[model samples]
Target: MAKKVIETSKAVAIAAKLCRPSVIAAYPITPQTHIVERIADFVYDRDMDSEFLDVESEHSALSACLGAQAAGARTFTATASQGLALMHEILFVTSGMRLPVVMAIVNRALSAPINIWGDHSDSIASRDSGWMQFYVESAQEALDRIIMAYRIAENKDILLPAMVCLDGFTLSHVFEPVDIPEQKEVDKFLPSYSPLYRLDPKKPISMGPIGFPNSFMEFKYQQQEAMQKSISLIKKTHEEFSNIFNRSYGNGLIEEFMTKDADYAVMAMGTITATARHVVEELRKKGKKVGLIKVKTFRPFPEEDIIKAASKLKAIAVLDRDISFGQHGALFSDIRSALQNKDIIINNFIVGLGGRDVTSDHIKTAFDKTIKAKQTITEWLF
Candidate 1:
């Protein structure tokens, strides 16, 4: 392993290069631009060998990735808020086709107010794209998750696309020391792409054929079952990753920080969870039993892991960086569903939308309110 101080975007590109995917199709958009640029540099410098396609737009970028993966090539791409929105339609197509294309998303706010800063509005909105989603906490996890994404996506039983989301600017542009594994070790962890199905002349098999009312539900059910089964593979891949690299995040799902015996805890994803960790430490010094839960995997939702985390707490505060119009925060909504019909008190706090900064004090205030607040209450944090 080689340790180097670098921005998360650069780490993403480096990790993708190390994975040695057969093809990479991507277009540049802020925060996410640097990652693709670095990958291009590796190709230019002859450090990485892969088919790199610089498409016209985000939609075409993912479209190319889907095409490449369907042709039996392991593919990768990167995008952010507006770019992701443009590719929304193709996102479902990629997943529905059961192509295991891995993409890196730098989470940013949706435009209209014309903000370029960081938030979870982008990836959180794409949660229903039928792709396995992972929220990273730091540059190291960003690099590690990209590697794990490939393994998880290409799992024989789970052939769905995967997304590795890093907070735009917050984690993507932020510089930190990261220990990157060698290509040899990564090769051991993630073997070459041997897809179960592909489009080729020798193998005359039909894919995405016409699905009438009779076959449509069965196809949808197959996708659902694959996603449900991915939960175990996600955990298994994380364990295998840790066993080989000696690094992991809470069994590849919900990472609990001081939540075992706490009276109240905060649940969040991305870098905000890292900030809440500090707030948890400070609040503990003051004799307040506050904790933090960092969600690593979002899709397969980690419902059971979260229930276990909230089992001992008096209350759990869910901090969401994305707001659902006319309703509560997105992460908060998911947590409530996970702990449904239970007598658990879960408070919802919406903070850090459109790149607004969320300081440690703000997180501490949320914890204080959650410790005493009841369920069914949602508050906006400034």
Candidate 2:
């Protein structure tokens, strides 16, 4: 296996090649441009047997993907902030149809005033649209999660769309060394996709049609069951991926560092966890008991796992890069819910909004505050 320094765009392209999508419907946007561009180049060069549908807008891109997936073709697409907002309506439709479409969302700040920098607002806004969302902290995680997402989403028990997110310029444009597996290995890991139900003229079936009140609830109930069932499928996929790649993602719910005997823990998502881990190491060296928890999956919320990890600690600090507005951070509310009825002290800190820098010192500051507060606080605004 050879290693090469590659940009996030190339890494994603390589991953797509591994997944072997049959159809790619995408429109170009800044920060997200290279990913689709590289894939298009791959298609142009006949390196992969796939259709690259160049649509006029994000709406059309998703719409095309929906049709392709409905026709029993493995589908993929890429988008950013404004583009994602444009596809908001179709996003719900994809989930409602239960089409296992895998998309790469280069996390970007949404606009009242147009901006292209990274933020979670774009994807978080559509959290309720029935899509399984996974936030990646690095280029490697982004690549790995895409492969895992396809397997998870297409599982017979969980036929739902999935969004794999990476920060706009931070991980997307930054160059890093990545290990890309061989095509044969990827093929062995991810075989050709076979949809349970698809639109076919020979055996036609209607999809995404309006259901009356009589059966609407049943459809929704099944969707919920599928989502609930995804938890186990997610775990199974991680195990299989570990067996093939020789690297384990550690349960696919949360990754904990030095939490076994720690009294204080910091919780975060995406790349910010990397900084938190460094601060935790420093605190440990100073004889302070501290740990870090990185949340990889956000949609399912992983309530039980969160409770199990944070319950034993005296104090837990949640650092959210995203804001829910009028409430605490998004993860803050969920952590509180997970700790309900349990005797545990939790603090919520909202930082790194609009792509602000969240340094190790900031994490250390939060940890110090948590230790000093010592169960006398509920939430601290950082």
Candidate 3:
């Protein structure tokens, strides 16, 4: 398989070709348009054996996905921002039913003032909805993670829906060189999805029905247990993918760059980590001890990995693309809770909201501020 430089749209089409979903339900929205448009073209060209459903609204898009998935078909969908908010109700239902539907969220800032640029608000709003979310920093990861998502979601121990998210426009519309595997290779890599349970007329089984409080609590408990079990299954799936693709995804939970012997570390997610890495390298050149921890998987939270990575550091800076009003950065709160016992100083920086550019210089400045604060303060926010 020869590597080729292709637009993000083409990369998604290539992923669709590999996944071979039986049903694709989506409502067009900016930034996310390229994904579904390419998939629709594949369906029209007869290159993919899937039903392209033009849903009336995002709510119906996910609702249709839920129905198709319950019928034991491989299902897929894509949405962003307001579109995702519209499907919020169905999102929870899909997870509770354990349908294992895979969705790609082009992470977009939510609106009251109407903005379509990148942010984590849309996905973070549904963080506790039982769906496993993976944030990708590049187009290659976006395509590759979707494949891994299906494998992890369909695991019998973790029959949960999964969301593979990428920053809108940043990776969605950017052109990059991606090595799209041959169809034969993809088929061998991802076998036919076999659901552990499905709605069959021959053997009628209840799904998504009204459960009383007594049984409902147990069902919720099972969902939590499944999420915990998915942590290991996610690692196993990544290993299998690496074996077949000859490309390792490091640790699927987190990717650390230059953090081995650093006194300060910056934690971030999505494409911002790419910028942070450059800043870390520049600081290292100047004899400044700095490193980065890029979080790839957000749902399971990767608490243990984060603590171990930040423990040796004298100070840590958390850069968040989303804010949690009245407090600090959304990820900052989570990181703080994870490191409460540790003696390391932590700083929170909220940036890149509503598509603000988070340049490498911005990251370097944050690091400088964090290191200075470490000399006297307990905690700092930039």
lDDT of all the models against the reference?
A: 0.90, 0.86, 0.87
The TM-score of candidate 3 is 0.97
TM-score of every candidate: 0.98, 0.96, 0.97
Location of the lowest summed lDDT over 10 successive residues in candidate 2:
373-382
Candidate 2 lDDT over 1-382, as tens digits, reads 4578999878988898789999999999988999999999999999989999999999999999999999999999999889999999999899889999999999888887777787788888888889998888878888889999999998888889999988888789989988788888888888799988888899988888889999999988998889888877887888899888876666887888999999989988888887888888888999999998888888866787888888889888888766787887787788888888787778888777666677887888888888887563444444
Q: Compose the digit string of candidate 1's lDDT tens values, residues 291-356.
A: 888888989798988888888777888889999999888888888998886788899989999888
- The better-scoring model by TM-score among 1 and 3 is 1
Off by over 4 Å in 3: 375-382
Clashes of each: 0, 0, 0
The residue ranges of model 1 lying beyond 4 angstroms of the native Cα positions read none
lDDT of 3: 0.87
Number of the predicted model whose lDDT against the real structure is largest: 1
Candidate with better lDDT, 2 vs 3: 3
